[model samples]
Target: MEEIERIVSGKKGKIDVTPIATIFRNEIKEEVTKGQMKPRIVAFLTTDDAGAIEYAKWTKIACNRDGIEFILKKIERLDLEDAIIDANNDDEVHGIMVYYPVFGGMLDAYLQDVVSPAKDVEGMSTTNRFNLYHNIRFLDEKQTKKCVIPCTPLAMVKIIDHLGIYDKSLPMGEHLKGKNVTIVNRSEIVGRPLAAMLANDGAFVYSVDISGVICFQAGKRQGTIKMTETTVTRDEAIQKSDILILGVPSPKFKIDESLIPEGAVVINFAGCLNVEESVESKTILVPTIGKVTIAMLERNLLRLYQNQMQSRSTSSSSSSAQIDQPQQ
Candidate 1:
């Protein structure tokens, strides 16, 4: 850790995300207020983890400000699955979020699968995960509606764009085609998904976990992703990365600061500090993503609401056409 201290002991810089989040928040607020949209979202908190509670609180506050009907429902871990199903069955609820670490491990994954795909605002369901990894843009075979993305990864990508890293002049699939990136967490929710998202966008990615490093990159075919074990050491990957991401949940775990290259972009989404304070001097540190997460959460809800509206309109139009047809 001392080595980390030595590397980042000087100047400091960080991306002020308030403006970016505000842009999203105001857009949401204006759309809802102007359109009179009452998109309802219910977030279930089944754990007493302070971080989860605080996140849920932020989610509710953001929703309220955006003029959406929001509820923070507290329930026991044992009943979370059933409660999610109830919310899924309720026509009034447009979106749903679950505070995680309830049961931890595969059980939590099972709970993720239980949430209805249409209402899973966080986009943590199995189907969404499949769509993300496979680069499927739409929820249906017709390809009319777009798929929902996990908020955190989307926020991170936004950060890169906001910071001027993404060359907008470049086409979509090639926006990040030239960058070498490193992400230091491999958890199912955040790390794994993020790596795939980056790879899908054409970045060469090094995904680091306790076991080892996995290489991720766009495949030879368009919209395809590939991952394989790599001989590149963590330090080597960090040294070469244009973008560095950290999401370790515990303070006990941290990047040895010495590994971070000077002027590299580093982003942290974890509640605890995953990198030393000094590293800010040597890197472009995106220290928090909570606000953007909230914005993305509401954004996903609006998308689902819009899809529902479109579906309703299409249904109505078809019904009218059928009724107007001459008797045959």
Candidate 2:
């Protein structure tokens, strides 16, 4: 845990996304008070898995705090796809999130594909995934208008920005440009999207799996991410990385303190034992996750509210125009 503290103390200080979340929540409250449409998020859970339940609870707390209504729908595995489709078509629902590890990981694909991109607050839909890969400005753009991004990776970026990893003077999207970032995991939810986002922002990203498969991709938007994979010892990648992100999902996974370069920025996304204690002071650590999720959810809800308000304004204007037209 000492390593965790050191990670927090690096750069400007302990990186906290709470302030970011608070800003969104306050904005949401203001909008609701002004008689704008209220936003609601529905979470579909097919299993009673501990992790999923915990996430559901967190999401509820976040929604409540942000002034958005939270609905939890527990359904059977067979009904998962239909349930997501229903939520997609529901005009009252602004966002949809499906808890994972359902049926021993049986329904992952359906959850990823069935949720509509418009309400996919977790950024699991194919359209959102493609946008994450192709648009570097996704995060900076209005969340309701752009592809919704996965909470964890979005949290990581916010934390890094909070810690001054990038120059504050530059725009948020350009912060990671030209940085060498190494992500030590390859999960579809976290590693893959993160790598794609960073690369899209002009950062040279290296994604490493536990099996020592290192995939290098240029952070450019002109073409497809032509990943060049090669097998190498893990230590080499650690030594070369400027900013290291730990998302490996193994409890026993630990990095050698000596391998971590001095002054490197370390982001612990998996909540696992990835960083050793010896290098705690030498690297900046970003360890919080809950606040980031809260922030992302608030941003998502605010965007939805904005879109709803815009639609209402347009309809109202059209109705007034029709009423003013001279009747024959």
Candidate 3:
């Protein structure tokens, strides 16, 4: 694939993802503009956070520009579950997304599960997550329909691939086999899923969280994830890592600059970047990906829309085949 990356030229520099994002937007626009009607995504925001609100606004703008329908529904937290069910059952809605931190904890997890898999564009639904962690890439026995992946982590994968870290000549699951990675955040939304994704793709991953650092690696079995609890310290993990992906929401939770090693690939998904500005010079730094993340959201919506179309076509064919068969 051609490089779509933008460079920041100065004493301190990092990778600007605007061009990569533009490539994704152009592809999605081309993918949807051919059809008479467009796929629709319903996003529910039950939080009052400024960031979430702004994200919703941009999501609408991106979707509109890509020829996809976008709806932002600000509703009561209590009614959010019921509203998701309604959207799930609604035929016109091709995809669903929920802005986070609403009811933060187990309740938010429950809300994630409420969105049906077919309409889950964010790929946060239990079924999609389960499939992702298990390294299951398809939705059907025939493998005709593909499964959805969470937008942020998928964007991370794409960015890493664009950087040429993943060798295309290698087998699918063996691309990152020799690399050691460290992921700082362990949130269900991004970190944990990302750790599993890399581990599944054959990286030895050090998953760091508030609790401790755990080692994630590909399982002995063909399609499984192996998690091993470790006493590895954050700095230790950072020192040995080939790639470091960080995401932490708090402004006070910045990563120590001295911890980053030379010649490492650094990717940050935090709204408030967790790494120091100077680290940009020492590493292959990806400071932010606001547009690229939005692009992944649009891509997921298109994939789910395709899945829906395939399901309809299959059902219609089955019905016609039954009608054309001899009466029994």
Candidate 4:
């Protein structure tokens, strides 16, 4: 087999995500300083989940480095919703994130629904979900008017854009035109949202699930997505795809090394051994979820602060105009 070039590791070596993360942090710190606001993020975590605990540790480190206060509240399965609600109502909490597998995923929906959309930094609220699905475009160049996007999908797109997969001169939705992309999972959090996003970006997207293959077409407003039952196997999809996304959360779901053609970009969202080691050199392995999540949290915090500032400025300008008006 011929040697495949690694996307993340190039001529200079493995791309340093640390510097990219630092840039995000510095920009956020500057925004917080200019706005004279203390930004804080509250994470509601399960008491016993080892993964959640480890994730929280990295989150704290990132928050500390960026000058944002990180608060971790341990809650039982029953009190999860209440904790999220409290975080939403707290004036100091600019962002709220809940670690998953809470009560073995039984309370995921309840916790997600209870968090206020304004504070839902993880983009789990119904409002954000609707906006993402509908391809709603916010006119504000600052993106303060749009809803928060899920970090994993956001990070994936950013990496791909950085790799010049998208035309830099054009808008995001026009970037992947003529590209054939395949996503190998359909979960709500990662796979489904990612498919919608990529489809909106004009890629010919094939979302594979046990049920069938769902084809997506980019529309002017609300894009069209159609699902059809098919007998196509995973290997068949991989063989024909230009870009392959794997989100299957199982070790047994490893891909056949021979199936991945040379120059195909592979992204693994599931933090497990789902892909073969040989693919690593040819793939862009997403950094740990915690790192990307922290970067996104900083972004959300800046947007929230900027929106608040803009609102205040608009209100103050209106008041001044009223004072200057002639009495009639």
The TM-scores of all predictions, comma-separated, are: 0.89, 0.80, 0.90, 0.82
Which model, 1 or 2, shows the larger TM-score?
1
Backbone clash total, candidate 1? 2
Model 4 steric clash pairs: none
Q: Which should have the higher TM-score, number 1 or number 4?
A: 1
Q: Model 2: per-residue lDDT, tens digit, 174-232?
A: 56666778898887788888887676555677788856655656534453464776665
- Candidate 2 lDDT for residue 122: 75
Candidate closest to the true structure, highest lDDT: 3
Cα distance off (Å), candidate 1, residue 189: 1.1
Q: What would the per-residue lDDT of candidate 1 be over residues 1-328, giving only the tens digit for each residue? A: 2333333343247655777788888999999988889899998897677877777777788889889888989899888878888887676788888887788889988888788766778988877877888777776555655678898998888767767677668887778978999999987678989998888777999999878999998888777888898899988999899888988878897888898888888889888778887787788787888888889889999997876666566665311110111111
Give one digit per residue, the lDDT tens place, for model 4 in 1-328: 0111343334211233454556567787776677677778888877777877887888888777777888898878688777776665565677788888776564677567677766667777666666678654431334545567777777667656665578656775678888878888887777878888887787877888777787765766545444444566667877888778877777787878678766677767676756676665655443234455578777876665455456456555311110111111
Error of 3 at 153 (Å): 0.5
lDDT of 4 at 126: 63
RMSD of 1: 6.9
lDDT of each: 0.80, 0.67, 0.81, 0.67
Kindly report which residue pairs in candidate 2 clash with one another. 7-285, 199-219
Residue 214 in candidate 1 has what lDDT?
A: 98
C-alpha positional error of residue 97 in candidate 3 after TM-score superposition, expressed in Å: 1.1
